[model samples]
Target: MTEPAPELVRGELTRELARAAVAARTGVLRVTGEPGGDLHVVHGLVVTVDSPGAPGVRALLARPGRTSTGVADLRVVAMMAAVDGCFAMASGWIGGCHWQDAPEAAGRPEEAMPPVPGVEPGWLLLETERRLGALAHGRVSPHRNHLLLTERGRAMLSGPGSGSRREILLWANGRRSCRDISMLLCRSLYAVTVEVVRMLDDDLLAIAPVTPDPPIPEPVRGIGRSLLPRRRRGASGINDTLPPRPPQPARGQRTLTPRRTERTT
Candidate 1:
């Protein structure tokens, strides 16, 4: 059997896991205590958790490979890393403990931070890109960030790279798929998918079901023929033509008639 197309694989995975990390993070992020620090009890494990402070959630992705978050806003930042893969857990201060030290009971109840093969300095960041791609309703395939967008997205579009911000609004008049947008801006579909899904995550975009392929209308003379058996050229066959309904009277067919009232002296 042929393997599913990459885009199809992405779409299906998106359908299945789009909420996996978010759900996981939501469970953990919410359990955290104040940034000063509190205990987060998850799946029955006791974790000394701290919420982010100061500049807020934006600081979460600013520094990846975190052990302490090392800055402010460690709680939300840690959750952000959990959802995106291990970007913040790769190194540095926050990366060391928060990410790497998964409660010994953490992940079999397995291990929390397992080794990833062929991982580089940027692997988790890249996987974060893929997770974003998995959030789209449209077909999306994975790719890199050498310049994932003519502009970057949540990763850069609204983060530390905001100085170079650009508009991401797509025109309603233009008929282009996410893939087309990716090509136009010199990005990969997965990258664009990240932007679109983030927009969705933030209520910036909402997706409506799309017609992947146009439907074929019934044939002129063979409509509904499959439901019935084929007839000989001269033999009678099932009549499948639908009759047109009579039109209703146009509006204003009846005009309003004002009634006169008699006044008593």
Candidate 2:
């Protein structure tokens, strides 16, 4: 059977993944962009997704107290990671993609946890689109905008809330964005973004004003190397060789008296 070309357009990445899934192709689809990543497909399902923009299942499971060893738990975590990874890519700039065929064994050892059931690319794309809609509704950019806690939020944190909310509040110091908080807490970027939006609606969080970068200092010119014209150096220069004028007589004397010279016979 003829295979589709490996190269993919930026916005068509998700659709191509869906096509690959429907075709039951097995391989790695490497996406390229600002924060691109790999989508490992087994048969037609996406086994796993790896993107720098979002934390992976390994990091999520590796948290201090997340010690679930059941097959069900692993599957849930893997699926969450996969969905979050897709969302991360879709939210950013996707330049293009390339696919390469490989045996399933090639990706096995790289798994942070045991194998879990794969997710359908079509469903994954839909879910990612839904997330994008939610972000749009909230008027928030998870990757671009920084967040900070309001006065009320600070007080609420002192009272009671979910641990996740508290961690987010603690990290929201007018510097970190939703993505930043997500990576720091090993939580899903979508989740963090939604939570941040809710907090904003509740007046508990505010978008931090982006501080403009400091202006670059102009280069300093050396003393004698100024751009203005240099003074002329040699003879024939009008001012260069002029003799000093004699001091004028005191205010009352208008003219100098001539000195009498005695002629010798």
Candidate 3:
């Protein structure tokens, strides 16, 4: 008889990743959930993380009118992408995950970028947890909440600006979320989220209320009319329907008469 394949214990994502790292596993852990992504593990170390919720190395390097082809630049961008992607995956809901053996390829083919140094799972988890705690304390969500610039934000833009703050201020028009701005600017999601939260604290930004989707109308029952039964004739040739009558006050209740309206016509 053939033996069953060893099943990976299902539990928290952090625990599973730690287990894989300890075992020195070389494979891809495909996590499934909202904004899910894959973690490329090499000899128990996480080299890269790919998630739709955050921009990747290529996107980070593909800034408008700017190009970087140096190996050093690539490594820096890859490191940022890995950390940001891990945060993106952990911040949201994770349904489940499964590991797949990939002995041949080091990373995804579509990446087309050279591999950088591998990051330890413990360090990655620690960094991600730190970021998560900071974001939670700031009451900001990179994926869900939309932001808008306040009067102070516009004023701040008029002064000498540095980093991505000016660009973020311009983009927060009560329509785009932090994730949207991150993709548009090709910046790290964690960085963008942190900046947005800071701006919010400085009274430079405000959270925009998300417009709820319109409720779906329920399907009408039956074909034409309602499915309710119609009035029927009684055995005495009278309709079963009762005649409309004015409401009467209950016993011991004061019955106040309604005021009559005077017609001018």
RMSD values, in order shown: 25.2, 9.6, 15.4
Q: Ranking under TM-score, best-scoring first? A: 2, 3, 1
Q: Who wins the TM-score comparison?
A: 2
lDDT of 1 at 25: 28
Residue pairs clashing in model 3 are none
TM-scores of the candidates are 0.24, 0.72, 0.71
Per-residue lDDT of model 3, residues 15-102, tens digit only:
7788888888878889897688999987788888999999998898897876787988888788888889988877776778889886
Query: Where does candidate 3 have its weakest 10-residue lDDT segment?
Result: 1-10
lDDT of 1 by residue, 1-265 (tens): 0112334323322332333333442123222111221223233322222322211133333433534534344554544434322211111012111222234543353354322211222233346445433443433221211222323233444454332123344321124444344444433333455665454455443333344698888767755858787668735433345555566668879755698999999
lDDT of 2 at 179: 81
lDDT of each: 0.34, 0.79, 0.79
Q: Write the per-residue lDDT of candidate 2 for residues 145-258, one digit (tens) a residue.
A: 789889999997888675667888889989888888899998888888888888899888899888899999998667465776776665457655787578888888889589
